[model samples]
Target: MTEEKLQDDIGVAAATEASPEEKSLREKFGDQVLSVSAGLDCEVVVLARECIAEACHYLKNTLGFEQIMDLCGVDNSALPGWSDASPRFEVVYNLLSVSKNRRLRLKVGANERDLVDSVTEVWPTANWFEREAFDMYGIIFNHHPDLRRLLTDYGFEGYPLRKDFPLTGRVEMFFDEAQWRCVYRPNQLTERVLVERTWPGVDRG
Candidate 1:
């Protein structure tokens, strides 16, 4: 099928019941983890600012998805993670149910200015992951006991993963006590300095 046709079909499918894998999940988990997108193994996504906490709780307690295998945050400001409403940051939760022997991936998108609910209450391992997400992607985990820089040094300015953040570098300042002077330099922006050369008889006085 043509690209346009395929896109139309996908839209229609989303309007109805998500694909088979997602249909099964809806039948199983009900409204716990909404299947916003579905294809091969079921791509379930939830809005972080809206239903992240509830979804994590259900997946852990009700669904017996005890183990949070991995948690990652992705910056989707450039390309929308989902539909038009997909936000600036996405918190992806990879869960494993040891008893049920199943694996699930839940994606939660948060607006640039909004924060996702913290899952540390359900999974202690989530603490570090959430902190990392906040540190790199700037996706805050609301209600986190402590939120601060992890990889970058304390008092770091911008979110490194953000697209708009400087890729070349940042400005740095230092004091030159030897010359009794202070120096400020923009690490990313530089200009060439030139000196004038004169002949032997040029302006000797």
Candidate 2:
């Protein structure tokens, strides 16, 4: 089918009712399930950070969401309409139920100092994904066996993906002939112009 047709179908499906999985999750977790909403093509569940591991266990073993397609982090501190009371960071998990032909997204809010429970025990693939999240967004994962930098170097200074990170980056690297090794130095940008960004549909005036 065409992309537009697919999107129309998804919109209709979202409008009709909540998915069976969403109902089950709400019924099971109750207060632990913060919110249930429809995404472009899947159901999204926002869970309390404390019970995320428990919810994932139930979703995998009982609900048959057997595969975790992806796991990533988001920094919402500078997002439009973000609330000051809400956590600044979020960890998102995309799960796929092959047998049921459905997808689900799980999100847990986390503060900068809070440690999110690692899901490596539930899904082994989460090991590297969690490490990458830690490396990029500085989100800590509790009980992760080897939570280290996956993409960045050992002495990387700052989380690159955060909204507050510099556009030119924290440091510059070059091969030093005298030292016979690669060396990193502080960024030497002479000038930077801060630009205000406006969203497409939002009116600033």
Candidate 3:
């Protein structure tokens, strides 16, 4: 067979072969999984927020995804060509199965006020990851015991990772020599400019 034809056959086979994790999730959850797609390094599954906790439990207990590798929040609102129909924010979970030598990515969408079910019960490491997400993006993890700021001051006003957050921040902190304590004062910047971002390979002119 020619090289091009051989490549085509390999692509076809890969597209037709469903990963075991995907098959198991589909068999167990049915419609709770909104969609599944191939990501750069692993299969990405988008699940309904209502079923996230249950799905995480199933993945850990049944599918052998024993480790929660990492979890973070994404603010898609400011992305170029982002759709308004989709949720403004998303929580992404990276799971690993050491026994099977496999990895999986799970995503759940949430709006500004939506509360996502915490997976800290499934993986204790998720405690700090959830708190960091909350601190940076204001993504609330429901039932996360001791959900508090993990990276910022307790009195910090806005979510720094949000696209709409000011560049200079709402407040500035300084150490007072006499009091020997950090003092926060309102930002006093008189002028602010919003710079337009340019992406590589995109022609503006």
lDDT of 3 by residue, 85-199 (tens): 9999999999999999999999999998899999989999999999999999999999999998988886788899999988888888999999999998898976467666887
Return the top candidate by lDDT: 3
Q: Which residue pairs show backbone clashes in model 3?
A: none
lDDT of 1 at 7: 98
1-205 in candidate 2: lDDT tens per residue?
9999999999898687877787888888898889888788887899999988888999999999999999999999888889979999999999999989889999999988899999999999989999999999999999999988999877888899998998789789999999999999998986467777777788888
How far residue 33's Cα lies from its native spot in candidate 1, in Å, is 5.0
Candidate 1 clash pair list: none
Off by over 4 Å in 1: 1-42, 80-85, 172-185, 189-205
TM-score per prediction, in order, is 0.66, 0.87, 0.89
Better model by lDDT, 1 or 3?
3
Cα RMSD of all models vs. native, in order, equals 13.7, 5.3, 2.5
Error of 3 at 174 (Å): 1.4
The deviation in Å at residue 182 for candidate 3 is 2.4
- Model 2 steric clash pairs: none
lDDT of 1 by residue, 1-205 (tens): 8999999999887667554435544666566554475425635556435777776786688777899988888876565234546566778888888887776788876776786789999999888888888888888788998877789765567787876676654756678888786665677665443655455556856
Worst 10 residues of 1 by lDDT: 39-48
Candidate 2 at residue 205, lDDT? 82
The local distance difference test score of each candidate is 0.72, 0.91, 0.92
